[model samples]
Target: MSFPSFLSHRLSLVQEQQLELAVLAEHVKRGSGHMRRLALECLAQRQAELAADLAQVAQLAAPRAALRKEVAA
Candidate 1:
């Protein structure tokens, strides 16, 4: 599933997550031109611990997102 969709599945508050997802979506929408793409890539390739970690970054940047991007950075 898509990243945002994945988040939506896990999070209860769809509206709030949507807002944050919208913004992050914009960050990712730039066709790999945006610097934040690095963050997205990190999310994509990472497994287990590192993957969860990057996911947390995205969650934190937005409003009440889920999985609370782990802080062990």
Candidate 2:
């Protein structure tokens, strides 16, 4: 083939490969975004459960404070 045709052929191949790469990259980005959102939701739920447990512990300790003070005196 002529030099011009050869260059055009090569450019076309390169363009095809680049398009495929762009599609793959987009899919990866979408998957990563979805996974990150899922992880964040799980973490938020766990944090809320931990907060509730801590609050319950605090409430139970409140009534014991008077006994502690009497013992200290």
Candidate 3:
């Protein structure tokens, strides 16, 4: 149960990061000034990095969950 809960939390983090990146991308498209676009792009990149980290955490959590299930059986 804990492993499933942890995976769910990590997945939610990934979803949140992706949503932020989408918002940043919209700002990059609509930004009036060069600096604004540049800043938005940087933020989008950081969000992508965070999402990737969350994905890795999810992958790690998957095996733990499988092990726990097998142990219970």
* Predicted structure with the largest TM-score when compared to the true one: 3
> Lowest summed lDDT over 10 consecutive residues: which window, candidate 3?
39-48
Give lDDT per model, in order.
Answer: 0.54, 0.59, 0.78
- Model 3 Cα lDDT, one tens digit per residue, 15-54: 7877777777777777779867786778867776996787
Winner of 1 and 2 under TM-score = 2
The candidate, 1 or 3, that scores higher on lDDT is 3
Ranking by TM-score: 3, 2, 1
All candidates: CA RMSD in angstroms? 14.1, 27.9, 3.4
Better of 2 and 3 by TM-score: 3
Structural RMSD, model 3: 3.4
Error of 2 at 69 (Å): 0.7
lDDT of 1: 0.54
Error of model 1, residue 61, in angstroms: 28
User: 53 in model 3: Cα distance from truth in Å?
Assistant: 1.8
